[model samples]
Target: MFGLWAPERPTEAAVRSEIWSLGARHQGRPLEGALAELEADEITSGRAALLRACVAKLRPAKVRR
Candidate 1:
């Protein structure tokens, strides 16, 4: 977890968008499951931000692999 600050967007949507974006990007390839989980409210806003930060932090690993 990259310890991102609480977001500026209205609490829920910022969180939702973050989750959707993370799901679209990470959670392994072919993101159907991640998208579904995000849609299902499996991720909280704080968690989404954290996950987003983590994914961003680890992106260099993806490039190297």
Candidate 2:
């Protein structure tokens, strides 16, 4: 397995902070489950929208090869 994890991978605390800042609908729910699903690119509901955005925003930008 490649240890290609980016140095700036989003952390749970970052995710929680983003959720609070965005007033995401799923704020009070367990974040681990939601984060798992998001990483899998599951079909998102309204509740997960803000979380999705936060994840995308927090990740380092991909460079075009």
Candidate 3:
């Protein structure tokens, strides 16, 4: 949710909270687009300001064959 030099770093607690939240949201799931098949799927944006935010978009996992 920030650009370089724009975000005001998030607190450790916030990062931890986001981690847990994302974890819960992804429980039993493949983390949305963590694979090649979901490459074109809609994405969830990262949060936590600038501490533990994930990528806003997803890159498909490469098929290793």
Candidate 4:
């Protein structure tokens, strides 16, 4: 739900890449801080939810391998 016309959800790899980019931009800040930056940038709730979902899926405790 993050597109202007297509309205598609990002893939897990896309989400991970975005998170990694955010980390690089923030320079060692926590994920929550990056999320906060996203929120401050006026990210939509749906997009925020997707990012949170990606975080959940990639969390250390949730990863199988």
Cα lDDT tens digits for candidate 1, 1-65: 44366463335555456546755666643244443444555678855554455444434554463
Ranked by lDDT from best down, the candidates are 4, 2, 1, 3
lDDT of 4 by residue, 1-65 (tens): 44576656778787777777766777755376556665667788667766776566546685487
Task: Report the Cα lDDT for residue 21, model 4.
Answer: 71
Residue 32 in candidate 3, Cα distance off native in Å: 7.3
For each of the candidates, the C-alpha root-mean-square deviation to the true structure, in angstroms, is 10.6, 12.9, 8.3, 5.1
Two-way lDDT contest, 3 vs 4, winner: 4
Off by over 4 Å in 4: 1-8, 38-41, 62-65
lDDT score for residue 42 of model 2: 57
TM-score-based ranking: 4, 3, 2, 1
* lDDT of every predicted structure (CA atoms): 0.50, 0.57, 0.42, 0.66
The pairs that clash in candidate 3 are none
Q: What would the TM-scores of all predictions be?
A: 0.33, 0.33, 0.38, 0.51
Most accurate candidate by TM-score: 4
Per-residue CA lDDT of model 2 for 1-65, tens digit only, reads: 25454233456677667656544545554354456556655563544665675656555699999
Model 3 poorest 10 in a row by lDDT: 50-59
Candidate 1, lDDT over the whole model: 0.50
Task: Tell me which of candidates 1 and 2 scores higher on lDDT.
Answer: 2
Write one digit per residue (lDDT tens) for candidate 3, span 1-53. 35764646556666555545555667723334133222434533333232223
